[model samples]
Target: MVHPIKVQLNDLMVKREEFEADVSLRSERLDAAGVGLHGSLLDKEGYPRADIDIMSIRTDRKRIAELTNDHKSVTNQIEKLIQELHAATKDSKPSHDRPSAPAASTTDKPPEQSNGIAAPVPAGRPVHAAQYSRPLAVVDGVSEASPASRAGIQVGDALVSLGGASWESGTISLQQIAAAVQASEGKEVPAIVLRQGETVSLKLTPERWAGQGLLGCHLRPIGDTTRG
Candidate 1:
């Protein structure tokens, strides 16, 4: 029979997965809004640019706020679950094996001091599956004046989904995104990305822009240390 703690951990894992998905979506939205606002709605100093769309920026900001709250709520829930799991495991430890203090005796000479001292035990770090899992592709760089740059595909943004497949769907990948672009033949392809804790949708048209590749961006799988 599965242990009760194991079941609880599994439940927490499922909840965490859901939270991750939500966080990625919110990040994308935030990135898209920021891209839209860059130069168009705000100047370098953050003052309103000439011909700025105040209404559009306001709407984007409101959405970002709502998404931020949602992301925070889910994150707090995940942390609480992790803490509870730690406590549960700690409580499950057998108390009988715990060391007892030695009785004081008149002959005891305050325990002989040792010349060599043991190293201090390091604190245990919280372990979460999310820490090791790569659920999306990361944009490492975007060429200037390229199709991707013009479409607001910024570096550090996580490509969570493309062409209707998402990381949550277990099939999203950089190669899949490239294939979607090639299949589009210069048409607009819908993409969902995670940027700064929000989900944002973008219409990416892979065309021969003033760059090397159609997208003109360097993409690496999340958790991949090597460049491609």
Candidate 2:
């Protein structure tokens, strides 16, 4: 027949097993954090960026309670073992040679910034050419030191020709001609433009400029009302 002490030990062992099972279940839940949930914001690559919601905290609280209860039960079992050892070593000094526990880790993340608003670009593409080829609606704040400004191009000038080579009106852009001019050696290039409803000509030369292509002028499209 099984002794009474043996039955009592078996019951304690079952309780320990149950505590271990609870720990394992809690670990599994933590590993599957935020499963199948939509995030509050999208990141630069258009993937969902997880945000901490109060509901997620509530979920974590339940797991933490389970973990705490399991830990308390295990600690009680350890205390019982310590008491038994104390009795056995009554004549001896308690060993102070136990390994120190490691410090728990914490990661305090900084607050996230909002990326929901899409800011509009002023023009379709930024900064167009003033060389006589393409015309863009002249907006206010067009630079005065650009090539367009030096060539008698006003804020209301429409491009017509460059070095006598004509382009389809409004089909060419300022950037393409500027790029070509950037690639060229210093020379006086003939240009034609329509300003205030009159066609005019100018010869322009690029200096070995310090900054990215500076012309000594500013201009705007002829029909643009935004120009000051």
Candidate 3:
């Protein structure tokens, strides 16, 4: 799901409008100032005053150009995001309420997923104690029987530990620890698996499965057991 808070289309639109307004107002003021300065130079008949006035005008023009570019860039970004938002919420109107900055809800999506590691929890309904459990970690795959499958590790097994480390389900940042698995390729990473009413230890090396290398297991939270 796309997070609306991290890069809010509405907020970007507001900023774009503000910048465009600033550019228009500043440009008009600049033109008026140029006309007034010209009249002053004509009356003064002084080279020093004319040079200073011209330099100041040039500086103002440059600043205006920079701001105009910024406005245009922001406008384009807003347009693109509007298209994306429309696609995501098709047939439904999006909430116009602006989310807070550093949108905790929107910006929390994982950058990438690899090595069977999960990303930080995205915004979702809170998991109650009844719906929590150990997530199963797969450590190896092989040509014959996958280690997890051979050991009867199914999709819903809660992973209880990794090399005896306490497995905190639902909150593991899979993106953060993918490197460790890549580095441990061919080496057995001891995994503590929690299957139906039982937990067992297994050491297995990573192997390719379904295109990407995996230990071939899924995890459920401890709360999943008590959930109706």
Instruction: Tell me model 3's lDDT, rounded to 2 decimals.
Output: 0.46
How do the candidates rank by TM-score, highest first?
Answer: 1, 3, 2
Could you estimate the TM-score for every candidate? Answer: 0.38, 0.31, 0.31
State the lDDT of candidate 2 residue by residue for 63-149, as single tens digits.
657767875675455435433433443434345542233333332111122642212112112211232224432311223455545
Candidate 2 runs further than 4 Å off: 1-147, 168-171, 214-228
Give the CA lDDT, 0 to 100, for residue 125 in model 1: 24
Instruction: Tell me the tens digit of each residue's lDDT in model 1 across 1-228.
Output: 755644654554455445545556655655665644232566779887665456756676566566567656654544454445446545666776433333455432111225332111111222122221233576655677988888888655667555444443344456665766787757776666655434466777788866567887766565442323
lDDT, candidate 2, residue 43? 58
Candidates 1 and 3, the one with greater TM-score: 1
Against the true structure, whose TM-score is highest? 1
Q: Which ten residues in a row have the lowest lDDT in candidate 2?
A: 118-127
Candidate 2 TM-score over all chains jointly:
0.31
Lowest lDDT sum, 10 consecutive residues, model 3, at 123-132
